[model samples]
Target chain A: MILAIDVGGTKLAAGLVTPDGHVLETRVAATPQDADAERLWKALEELIAPMPEAEGVGVGCGGPMIWPDGRVSPLNIPGWRDFPLRERLAASFPGRTVRVHNDAVCLAAAEHWLGAGRGHANMLGMVVSTGVGGGLVLGGRLVNGGTGNAGHIGHVVVEPGGPLCGCGGRGCLEAVARGPALVAWAQEQGWSPGHGPLDGGPYEEGRAVTGRGLASDALRGDPVARAAMARAGRALGLAIASATHLCDLDVVTVGGGLSQAGAPLFGPLEEALRAHARMDFARRLRVVPAALGQSAGLVGAAALILAGDRYWDAI
Target chain B: MILAIDVGGTKLAAGLVTPDGHVLETRVAATPQDADAERLWKALEELIAPMPEAEGVGVGCGGPMIWPDGRVSPLNIPGWRDFPLRERLAASFPGRTVRVHNDAVCLAAAEHWLGAGRGHANMLGMVVSTGVGGGLVLGGRLVNGGTGNAGHIGHVVVEPGGPLCGCGGRGCLEAVARGPALVAWAQEQGWSPGHGPLDGGPYEEGRAVTGRGLASDALRGDPVARAAMARAGRALGLAIASATHLCDLDVVTVGGGLSQAGAPLFGPLEEALRAHARMDFARRLRVVPAALGQSAGLVGAAALILAGDRYWDAI
Candidate 1:
């Protein structure tokens, strides 16, 4: 069995996964927002308290994380910057193989192992959620760039001067296509999250306009809502086209909250991708929804050790 | 010693290199434009005739080539379409290890092995001649993207609605940044290659307005000429920014005749890249001129086998 720890801005979860890739036991806790370092550590300890002994452990967390040594300064979780989560975790569980990876990379690894990206030699796995993030599986091996930041597609430029990004850049794909950006654009077009449509389809009273709510609104035939998603798809498609061209990738699997937007998100994404990808090499790109959902982080983290020589790190 | 061959639109060159990466002997031949298959075969045959006894051979040609079993239909050498260059070369060599790679990939491999990209774990190598081409080395392994076309950055769209690309796409980087396109744009601005300046910087008669002529003019302080190159640089920088972002590259080494245009070509390229690359991971990308110049192809092709387990093709 392997121990899998998943750290996110809002949650801390731990699971005991089997050799055949099954999560036999799991523990969860809400990550207190803006909590101090000690609180975060205590929450993690509580999350993993129920996990049984295992041969190896994998921790998947948001980046800017240092590679190998595993230090992280995740956005949103403001309490932790340059946090040595790996060192602390390793110290907690002595004599067990421990590995840390970017949460999106873990998601990609999980998808590659047991979901949509399986059997592809070279793939790009993306998570378009509160933020856009990605990971690469090249030549059938997960790539770890020197900084372990091999995939950061969110910051790639699609529109040269469109808008200012949180990353301090203009026209970043994330700035144009992420969940918040979509909602913001929809609002500009008279879309209010809780307001719904004038002749709304099955509106729940006082529903907040969250990313999920925006997706449901599009499904209920809101033109402005649909347009917002389409705009996101267009920007994402352009960036994917650029990526497919550069990486010669055969497939791209997308997950995360925006992915839950389903066909409303994918339909326009595919259309725009088809429109932009015209070359023979890039024409064959396959964009698909990720199969594994939230559990991907934990599973992929487990695979870091359970998958054995797959890292190809030594090579 | 290893046998190395470089096939290009304009030239076919072959060499025998020592184990220490030295070219012991070489041969050159002009690749006749639009020649028939027989003529192309004969040229290759003649080029490889005088090679010394070698354990293996590596051929690097401009692509649209198949991997593992190499078949190439180079854009410039239209004499053969889908020609089995690998099969034919292997047949002649008789049981020796004969490998074929895209010339640009070979350049990347060469740069990774013995040139500007040396010591960098992940690198991008580019060739910006009649057409643009590129290759990648991720985590120190030459990436073939299964079809031997992973790094076709030339066809990646930088300007979504700008112009038509030969690959049936709109606003491909190649359409904006290639020699032909640069020359076309320069002419629209009333810059004539042979005409030089109104009070010419050192006027010479009978110079045709080829891509090389345009670069020469730019070197002589022609505003229109310099603008054309800078425009190309801007497009290139945007494309490189996208590539660097997607690949999380360490260094980008550029070769090709245009690179010889010197700082005028690079000055703007760097500026544009920096302007687009805003993220810390991307900001660290180092762009440099390619070393080994014209011979990178031959030497890199030889590296396919010479580099030992580095190819990771079987995995």
Candidate 2:
């Protein structure tokens, strides 16, 4: 069995996974947003402490992190800048193998290993949530780049002069297509959260505007919401087209919250991808929703140890 | 020693190369513009007929070919569509090995093996000639995608809704930055051939407008020509930034005819790259002119056999 840990800005999760990738036991907790490095470490430790003994430990944490050594400083987790994550994990789980990688990369691993990207030798697995990120699997193995940040598609410039990205660039795919960014764009176009059919009832009063709200509104035929989804979708398509041409990809699996928007998002995405991905080889690519869902991060974290030959190369 | 062959739209070249990548002997011929497949083959046969025998043969040919099998149907070469190139070579050199790959991929392999991209584990080697194309080396090995067409960056969309490309796409990097495209754009902006100081003499009469002429004019202080180079440079930078973010690249080497434009192209390229490659890791990337000159394609073909461990993996 392997102890798999998934650390995100919103939550911390741990699981005991069998070698074949089944999760036998799991634990979860809301992440303390204001926690210091030690406190965050303690939260992770407590989350996994009750799990049965395992042969090794694998972790999927948010980036930007130093790979192989695994010092993390996720953008959303302000309290854990440059935290010595892998070192602490190693100290806590002495004598057991420990592997740490970016959560997006982990999500990609799960998709490639057992979900949408399965059987595809050249695939790009992506997530479009609070941020848009990805991991690449090429030649049937993970492409760990110069610094283990190989498939970071979020920063790919999709719009030349459209919007400023959080990474300090203008017109990044993430800036245009991330969940919150879509919701914000919708709101700018005069969309109100409670105006849609799904949010008109008393139970939904005072609900905050969110990407989920925008998706629901788009499904209910809200023009502004649909336009916002289309905008995000187009951005995603352009970036995917660029990636497809550059990598000669076969399959592209998209996951995370916004992907659940279904037709509203995917419709425009397919159209834009078809328009931009014009090369013969690029035309052969398939873009689909990721199959592993919410537990993908945990499964991918476990894959680091269980399927080390393909997913894990860093010591 | 290895026999290396380079097939391009305008020319065909073959060389005898030492194990360390030195070209010991070479032969070149202008490709027949309207020859049939058999005639083209005969021309190639005649070109290399005088070469000394070698243990194996490696070839770099213009693409859209069936890789490993080496059936070629290059876009510029209308004479050969799906020609059985590898099979013919194998038949001609019976007991010896023959390998074939895209010419752009060969240039990348050459750069990685012996030129500017040396010592870099993750690099993108590109050519901006009549067409814009590239090859990628990741984790110190060539990344051959599902169709063995990995690193064909010409089709990467850089300008959405900008210009129509030959591949039936709008706003492709090739459409914006390739030599002919840039020349066309410059001409449309009221620039004419033979107007620059370098082309004023009698010997330069009747010379067509070319990317080289535009670069020369830009260096000699022509506004339209400078703007054209800047446009191409910016497009290149945007594509490079996207590639760097997606692949976590360390070094980018730009080669081919237009690359000789020097500061007129590279100045804007660097500025745009710095503007868009804003990620902390991406900012670490270095974009430089390709070190190898016109012989890069031949050298890279040789590397397919001489450094097969890093460049050639297909059967």
Please name the candidate that would achieve the greatest lDDT relative to the true structure.
2
| All candidates: DockQ | 0.67, 0.84
Give a tens-digit lDDT track for model 2, residues A1-315. 999999999899999998888888889999988888888888888898887477899899999999988899987788898898888888888898889999999999999999999999999999998899999999889988889999989999888997999999999999999878988888888988745345342225554576766777787788898899899899999899999999989999999877867899999999999999888989999999999966899999999999999998774
Name the lDDT of candidate 2.
0.89
Which candidate tops TM-score? 2
TM-score of each: 0.94, 0.96
Which residue pairs clash within candidate 1? A193-A209
Residue A218: error of model 1 in Å?
Answer: 1.4
Stretches of candidate 2 off by over 4 Å are A194-208, B194-208
DockQ, computed on Cα atoms, for candidate 1: 0.67
Specify the highest-DockQ model's number. 2
Q: After best superposition, candidate 1 residue A293: deviation in angstroms?
A: 2.0
B143-253 in candidate 2: lDDT tens per residue? Answer: 899889999788888889989998898999999998788888888999876454453422255555667677777877788888989999999999999999999999999
Model 1, B193-225: lDDT tens digits are 754433233345654565567777787778898
